[model samples]
Target: MAFDFDLFVIGGGSGGVRAARTAAATGAKVAVAEESRMGGTCVIRGCVPKKLMVFASEFGAEAALARDYGWSAEPGEFDWKRFQTHLKGELDRLEEVYRSLLKQSDVTIHDSRARVTGPQEVALADGTTVTAKTILVATGGRPVRPDIACSDLGIVSDDIFGLKTLPKSILIIGGGYIACEFACILNGLGVEVTQYYRGAQILRGFDDEARGLVAEAMRERGINLHLGTNIVEMARAEDRWEGPVPTASDAAMSQALKGAASPLARREGGAHRPGEAGPIWVKGTNGQQDVYDQVLFATGRTPNTEGMGLQDVGVKVNRRGAIEVDAYSQTAVPSIYAIGDVTDRIQLTPVAIREGMAFTETVFKNNPTAPDHELVASAVFTQPELGTVGMTEEQAREQEPVEIYCTSFRPMRSAFAGRPDRVLMKLIVSQASQKVLGCQIVAPGAGEMIQLAGIAVKMGATKEDFDRTVAVHPTISEELVTMKTPMRTA
Candidate 1:
C-alpha cells in the first residue's frame, strides 16, 4: 500500500529522533511530529538544564573551600535570573542542533500534535492526515503531583527549569533522585531547603549504606531533611487564609504549564486571582504547619500515552498509561511501535537512545537487536554524588551469599582544609563465585569513578581481579583496588 512516508515518528525525544534519523539513513522516508520542542525532555527540560544548575549551585561550596585553601574567595548571592537567561539560550542552541540533524537525515519535521488515526494513518492536530508504513511512539513522560488539597500551590521538576526566579525558601517533596538533587542544588544556591520524604529513607532502590550516608550528608549541609512525613493539607497564604486556589489544582497548574517557557502556577478558578503570587501554607504528617515561598514536588513521573489515540488505534498500554511493547519495541499492531519512557522499560535517556538504535537495527537493517540493560551505571547528582552499578548489597544478598567491603573516611583535600565531609567506597562481592557483584561510591567525583568501576562489574570482574590491579596512589578510587578484606559476609 502507498503511504505518505515509510515511517512517522510521533515524538522528537532522544529515542524518536534517533529512530527517525537511523531509519532515514537507511533510505526510508521519515517524518517526525513534535508538539513541544525538538530535543524533547532531557535536552530541553530535564538533564541538561538540571546539570547546569547543579554546576551553578556547587560554586558556593567551592568558594567556601577556597578560603580554607589560603585563597580569598567569598561566595556571593546567586543571580538566578542571569543564570536562567544563559540556560534558556543554551537550550535554544541545542534545539536548533536537533533540527539540523533531522534535516540532514532527510526527515520531515512537523511542529504539531499527532495521533495514530488508523493502522497506517496519523492525524495531526491541524486536521492533516499522513499515512506511513510504520509509526513510532516515543512521547516520553511528565512529572506528576500527588493527590492533596491545594496541591496546585506546588511545582514539579520540569517547572524548576522554567521558573522566573528561585525562591528564598523551598519545601521539596519526595525522596527520589530529582528531589534529593534539587534539594542539594537549591540549598547550595543559598536557599533554605527543607526536604520531606514519607519513606523511611531516600533513594529507595539504591544501596542502603550509600543512601544513608547521603541522607546524613544532606542533613549536615542544612537541608532540614524530614523522613516519614508527608503533607496532610495545604492552603493559600492570603491575609484571611482560605483553602486551595478555587480555580486550578496543583495538578492542573502542572499540566497547564507543562511546556511553557516560564511556568508560574496561576490560579484561574472561582475567587482565586490569576497571576498573583500565592504563598502556600502546608500541614505535615507530623502536625507541623508552615508557609514556604515555593513547594516543589518530585513525587514521580507518568508515561505520556494519554489522548494520543493509542487505544483507538489498537496499541496496548498498562493501567499507568505506559505503552506495552515487545523485546523489539514492537506493539501489538505490527505497523506500530513504542520506545523510551512511554514503554516504561528504562527511563534513562541513554537507555532510550539504545532502544532506538536497536529498533532501527531490527526494523531497517534486518539484524534484530535488544538494548542491553544489565549492570547499568547511574549517578544521583546530590552534593557528594552517589554512583553505582550492578547490584546493591541487599539485592545481592537476596540472590546469594555476599561479602561486603566498605570504607568511610575524610578525603585528603577536605581533611586538609579542616572540613568534616567524609567519602564512602563500597563493593559487594558474591561469596561463592568471588565476583564483585556491584560497587557504590559516595564522593565529590563518585560519578566519574563509578563509570570505570562499572566497566569491571559489567565484565563480571571478581574481587581477585580488582586485587590484582595496582593502586593509583593517593587517589580516592585507589580504594577500589587496595581493599583486601571483606568487612562482612551475609
Candidate 2:
C-alpha cells in the first residue's frame, strides 16, 4: 500500500528524531512533526539546561573550598542575566543542530503539532493530513502542578530555565530528584531554599542509606528541608499581607529591574514573572506559614498523550495516560508505535533513544530488537550527587537473601577543609549467586563513577569479579572494589 511516506513520527524529541533519521537512512520516506523545539525535553529544558544550572550553582561552594585551601578565592554574585544569555544561545545552536541532522537524513520536518487521526494516518496542526505505512509517537512528558488551589501561582520545572531573575527565596515542593537537585542548586546559588516533602524522606525508591546521607548533606548545606510536610494552602502574598511585603533580597530586586525589559518577565502563565506578582504565602501541613519569592512544584510529570486521539485510533493507554506498547514498541494498532516518555517505559533520554533504535530495527530493518530496560544507571545532580544502578537493598532483600556492604566517611577534599560533609558508597550483593545486585554512591563525580560501575553490573558481574579487580587508590570510587566485609546481611 503506497502512502505519503513510509514512516510518520508525531514528536521530534530524541526518540522520534533518532527513529526518523534511522528509518529514512534505510531508504524509507520519513517525516516528523514537532509543536515546539526539536531537542524536546532533554536538550531544551530537562537535562542540558538544568545541568548547566547545576554547574553554575556549584562555583560558590568551590570558591569556599579554594579559600580553605589558602587560595584567597571569593565567590562573586551570580549574574543570572549573563548566564541565561549564554544558555539561550546554546539552546538555539542545539535546536539548529537537530534540524540539520534531520534534514541531512532526508526526513521531512512538519514543525507543528500532530494527532493520530486514524490507523496509519496523522493530522497536523496546519490542517494537513498525512498518511504513512507506519506511525511513531515519541511525544515526551511534561511537568505538572498538583491539583490544589492557587497551584497555578507556582511554577513547574520547565519554568525554572525561563525565570528572568533567580528568586532570593524559593520554597521547593517535592522529594524527587528534580526537587532535591533544585533545592541544592538554588541553595548553592545563595537562595534561601526551603524544601517540603510529604514522604518520610527525600528521593523515595532509592537506596535508603544513600538517600539518608543526601538528606543530611542537604541540611548541612543550609537547605531547610522538612520531611512529611506538604502545602495545605497557598495564595499571592499581596492578598494576605496587610502592608508592603518584602519578597526578594536587594540584589535580586536590582536584577529584576535590569531584566524588567525582557519579555520573559512580562510573559503570562508557565513562565515566571519576578515583579509582576508579589511573594507567595504558603501554609504547610506542619502548620508553618511563610512567604517565598517563588514557589516551585517539582511534583511530577505527565505523559503527553492527551488530545493525540490515541484511543480514537484503537491505541490503548493506561490509567496514567501512557501509551501501551509491546516489547518491540508496537501498539495495539499494529501500524502504530510509541517510544520514550510516551510509553512510560523508563523515561530517561538514553532509554528513549534506545527504544527508538529498536523500533527502527524492528520495523524498517526487518530485524526485531527489544530495548533492554534492566539495570539502568541514573544520577541525581544534587550538591552531593547520587549515582545508582540495579535494585535497591530493600528490593534485593525482598527477592532473596542479600548482603549490604556500605561505608560512610569524610572525603579527603572536604575533610581537609574542616567541612563536616561525608560521602557514602554502598553495594547490595546477592548472597545466593555472590553477585553484586546493586551499587550506590553519594559524593562528587558519582555520576561518572556509576557509568563504569553500571557496565560491570549490566554484565552480571559477581562480588568475586569486583573483588578480583585492583582498587584505584586515593579515590572515592575505589571503595566499591576494596570493601571486603558486609555491613549487614538481610
Off by over 4 Å in 1: 239-276
After TM-score superposition, the amount by which residue 228's alpha carbon in candidate 2 deviates from its true location, in angstroms, is 0.7
Model 2 poorest 10 in a row by lDDT: 258-267
lDDT of the candidates, in the order given: 0.88, 0.90
lDDT per residue for candidate 1 within 415-488, as digits (tens), equals 99998898999999998999999999999989899999999999999999999999998989999898989899
Superposed on all Cα atoms, model 2 deviates from the true structure by an RMSD in Å of: 5.1
Which residue runs of candidate 2 sit more than 4 Å off their true CA positions? 248-276
State candidate 2's TM-score.
Answer: 0.95
What RMSD, rounded to one decimal, does every model reach? Answer: 6.2, 5.1
Worst 10 residues of 1 by lDDT: 254-263
